[model samples]
Target: MNCYTLIKQKILAVITQLQSNGGLPADLKVDAITVEPPKSRDHGEMSTNVAMVLAKAVGQPPRVLAELFLTHIQEFDEVRTADIAGAGFINMRLHPSFWYAHLSTILKEKEAYGSSDIGQGHAMNVEYVSVNPTGPMHAGHGRVAIVGDAMAALMEKGGYDVTREYYINDGGAQAETLARSAYLRYLEALGQDIGEIPSGLYPGDYLKAVGESIAKNYGDAFKDQTEEEYLPFFETYAIDAMMDLIRDDLDLIGIQHDVFTSETAIVNEGAVEDVMDMLEEKGLIYTGVLDVPKGIEVDDWAAEPQLLFRSTQFGDDVDRVLKRTNGEWTYFAKDIAYHFDKFERGFDYQINVWGADHAGYIKRMLAAVKALSDDTVTLDIKTCQMVNLMQGGEPLKMSKRSGTFVTLRDVVEAVGKDVIRFVMLMRRNDAMLDFDFDKVKEQSKDNPVFYVQYAHARVYSVLRQAEAQIGQIDEVQLQNADFTCLNSDDEIGLIQVLASWPRCIEGAVIHREPHRIGGYLYELAGAFHALWNQGKEDTTLRFIVDDTKVTLARLALLKAVATIIASGLNLFGVEPLKEMR
Candidate 1:
């Protein structure tokens, strides 16, 4: 059902025939050639640049090669017209019969129309929302989480054995800080008048519940305990509570991770030491001093030797430190260990979805993966720009719950999970997005999620009307839908858009950008809405007509639209509404 792929195959057949008959060079490489939709449908339904790709290889001008291909493609039984555009591009208008036939293809394929076997079931690990288990997630964390979850879904649709993962930074100093922060709340829960929280510890009201829980369980048992006596139990308790809250928050927004990897477990199981040994065996680790960052003077600069990894050999700007002068493994060391664990678990591909603040950390992590896997496992790091929570055309103030920023749960609760998921993903992951409360809440075309959902609901409404007025259009009738009844330009144009779903998904998965699906769905909805508007003006253009055949044909098309939208919304983890309230 992918027109581009179908046309590309036919053009390849043409090239092969020409090669066989010696009309073109026998040794020409056709892999670089492409067939795509033209800038304007007025030019043609599809276009190809085969001549431009192969002209120089054959020692001929591109226009001459274009003419040769045009003459051959004009003989295609399905082609209505074939013309040469500027230089070497060939534009083609396929017969409406060609597009009409694919409508049945849509009904037959159903939700599997856009699916692909690109991944071939290879294991893929997508690690995202790896925030410290210290507090509730903020809007930025929510954006990353949604992007990662949706991207994983997209990959799964593309046939990758995808696993969504969350790496908890519980092994670091932040977890200890959280435990100490909870201890203060614990004392307060026991009727002690603890003053304002210390500056370095968490100050969120959300942690108050964690402290109260601890007090309720162990009333005053460790009130006077030292750091060594209370730190272990408190750290474990706080992280477990925070992680449970995080899990609940994720559930509130309809995201569920397949695996939750603990950073402390990685370190506690000697993964950090094992990862270092593997790197040392590969001669990637060394003892050296890092140069001071250029244009930035350090007040306490040192030239002493330290443990480092030769990350520069693998495209990083500079080598990275594995161990600090204090003899403690750096945070980067733990990250390398975590990725190594993913690799050892047999993930052929790993993707990390990080917030924009972590952009500078990408190269070193990639370098470590390359070094450890010897380029066997591929790693891709996607960064989601921060979400600007706007109200009345301006950024909102900090949240009272998180005490630092707007909590993800608060926004989801305010607008509902569907709105939060859709608006957060309304833009490219690497581009800044404005989640405007006033705009998304308004049920207008300006709201993309609403527009898309309305398109879906309209299709269902039309289907209901058609069934009641034109009699039941059963599954057999739809399977045998008379596509010739759909001869109007607008009818065919919408079908053309619908036919491109498989191509859209394949490209999205290949580029590692599922944001494209949002744009595609918007365009699909626009086309569908345009046709619905047309039907309103001309009764003959209506989906339900006196002629039972035309009514059934158009109803089949509407069903296809609903199916595609539902498939897309399922990937976004958002519900596709059959009726909007």
Candidate 2:
């Protein structure tokens, strides 16, 4: 169903025939051959660099090779003409029937039309929104959640067995801080006049309910207990409460993880020691002093030797310390063990969606995965940059109710889940995004989400109008319509875009860039809107024409547009609206 792929295969077949006839060298490499849309529509429908790529190897000039390839390619019935363009590029124009038949495929296949099988069912673990279990998720975490979930969906569409995961950061100082924060709330619930929530403790009002729940469950039982005894109990309770809060926040935005891995559980299961021992056996672990990182001014820097991992051998900039001088395992030690556990779970690929602040950690994490899987498994880390929330072009400060940052729930409540998810993915994950309250909710072309959804709504409206004006046109009638009547330039251009859906999905999955889907959806929407506008200018271009045959064909095309839009929106976890209101 991918026209570009189909054309490439045809070109390769011609090259193979030429090789057998000694028209080209047998050993010429063809892997670099690519067939894509011509840079300018004036050139041709599609263009390829196959001639230039194979010319040197086949002992011929690029122009000579281009002419030879063009002669053979033009012989195919699907191709109307093939011409040599700049630098010996082969540009091709396919017959109109080819595009019309592809449009028919789209109507029949509907939402499943653009699916791909490139992943071959490989297990891929996409870990995202691994924010600490200390508080509710923030705006940045919302971006990560949307990116990861969309990526998982994209990979799933591309035939990968995807597991959406969240790694809870509950084994560090952050969790302890959360526990202390909850304890203060617990004291407040008991009517204690604890003033101004000590500087380091969480001061969000959301924890007040957790405190009340704790009091109701255990009734002054731990009021007299020492910090050592009560801290553990409170830490466990607070973490559970915070996780519940986080899940609720994510639920508002249609995000739910298949797996929620706990760092403490990994440590408790001796995973850290197991991985350290394995690395030690490979001579990657050692006791050594490390130089301070450049530009870091540590007031209490230590010079003593410590347990370290030889990560430099695996392409990391420096050997990392597994355990500090105080003998506690470092965060990196637990992270390494976590990835080893992921490998042992039988995933062939692992993807981590991290905040932009964690860019420096990518190399070390990749090194850990490489060492653990012996470079057999692939790990791709996508770092999501900051999201600046704005109201009328002015940046908004942290929520006073949330204490530190604007909660994900705050944004989702302001703009519904659909807007939040769609707008978050409108940019590349590594690029900074501005989420404007006034802009995203606007019902104009300026808002990508609204524009795309309006396209779907417009399609539905056309179908309704067509049914009321002309008699009802069901699936069978639409399928049997004479698509050859769709000879307008706008119609043909739209078919070309729709025919590229499978190729777009494949490229997006291979690049691990879900933003590409958003971009493609916007482009498809624009083409659809353009065609709709064309119908307004020319009476002959109207979808619901006097001719029943032409009307059915145009209806089929509009349905195909809606089908693809719904398909792409589903991957983004956003609903395609049937009506704009």
Q: Over the stretch 441-542, how does candidate 1's per-residue lDDT look in tens digits?
A: 888788999999999999988888877886776777887988888888888998889888888999999899988899999999999999999878888888
What lDDT would each prediction earn against the true structure? 0.90, 0.91
TM-score of each: 0.98, 0.98
> What's the residue-level lDDT of 432 in candidate 2?
98
**TM-score for candidate 2, residues paired by index:** 0.98
- Candidate No. with top lDDT: 2
Regions more than 4 Å wrong, model 2: 297-300
Q: Would you list the clashing residue pairs of candidate 2?
A: none
In candidate 1 the C-alpha lDDT for residue 575 amounts to 95
